[model samples]
Target: MAHETPRHWDRNMRERLRRGEAAALAELYDRFASLAYGIAQRVLDDEAATGAVTREVFGAIWESPERFDPRQGTMRAWIAGQAHQLAVARLRERAAGPAVREQVAAAATAARADYIVTAMPAPLREALELTRFQRQDYRQMAERLGINEDEARRRLRLGLQLLSSAAQYGAESADPTGGRPAPPRELGSR
Candidate 1:
């Protein structure tokens, strides 16, 4: 898939899978296994469950490649969505009382935030990473990214806004939705 366009790659992958090509499935697994594992891990927080979810996600995709519609989104999004849904279902299964349900919701919300940050456009991701990991302010981020302060501020703000939507995303899947409204406002807040 070197230098191949995503649409082309998606189309080719679908065709290959439809033809029952093992190599295609291997390629797809290689490309997305980590992403699937990470999303499942974030939601389930259990090694065995996460591993099971990863295999189930890839197995479902391989069994029904037609379910993946590139028109709706990229293959990456499809895989992530499936992994998230399955993990949430597993979480719901294990949850008992209302308190446990709320905790599950929060875990799902944090997982969604992780997915959002991972999927953010490069510039915004970089800005947020600088602030979070490097402890940089907007001006400092600008200097590090070689962009103006305003651009740095804009990217960070946009990234944060995207992250803040994690709660809403979680609510869509959360049964009795009550959790932190968003990812933590500060590193210390968590």
Candidate 2:
């Protein structure tokens, strides 16, 4: 059978799905599951979470095909949007109750920190890791690394400067539209 393009096939599939045709749902899954999974993975960054989000999206479509209105957008866009939302919701849920919003902020900060730390020179990386991760004070770090205390402080300062610059660059490049951040989801509300 020659399959129609998604633009046309989605319309027919939606109707079949609404009529409770199982094969239609399977066809839709076969067509869009990878796209949905990619969106979920990009948003959630965890394989288990991505799987959950993808399954939730397909289940929602199966249960309520009417929720997808053709006038609003193409079926692909609709599914991708749903995947993004579900992935974000799962992230918020993982943050635990009232701290959902804080979790997002913390995750972004952690991600940026990781990127900067990974990019640092070996000496700077060692200095920062000793102080931050190992809870070593300047004197202890200097003794451990066989450097003077002033040199240890200098390395830490340089590492922080690099991190700050990288973070600024990241923020500038993040969204070209200068739009506000996505609204945070309430924990357990989804």
- Tell me, by lDDT, which candidate is best: 1
Strongest candidate by TM-score = 1
RMSD of each: 18.1, 14.8
lDDT of 2 by residue, 1-190 (tens): 8878766776887899999999988888998999999999998889988998999999999999999987787999999999999998777777666464455455666686687678667888999899889999989999999999998998988877766654454444444355554332321121
Runs in model 2 deviating more than 4 A are 1-5, 96-190
Stretches off by above 4 angstroms in model 1 are 97-190
What tens digits encode model 1's per-residue C-alpha lDDT throughout 92-148?
878776777678778988998898787777888899899999899999999988999
TM-score of each: 0.50, 0.49
The lDDT for every candidate, in the order shown, is 0.86, 0.80
Clashing pairs in 2: none
Clashes of 1: 0
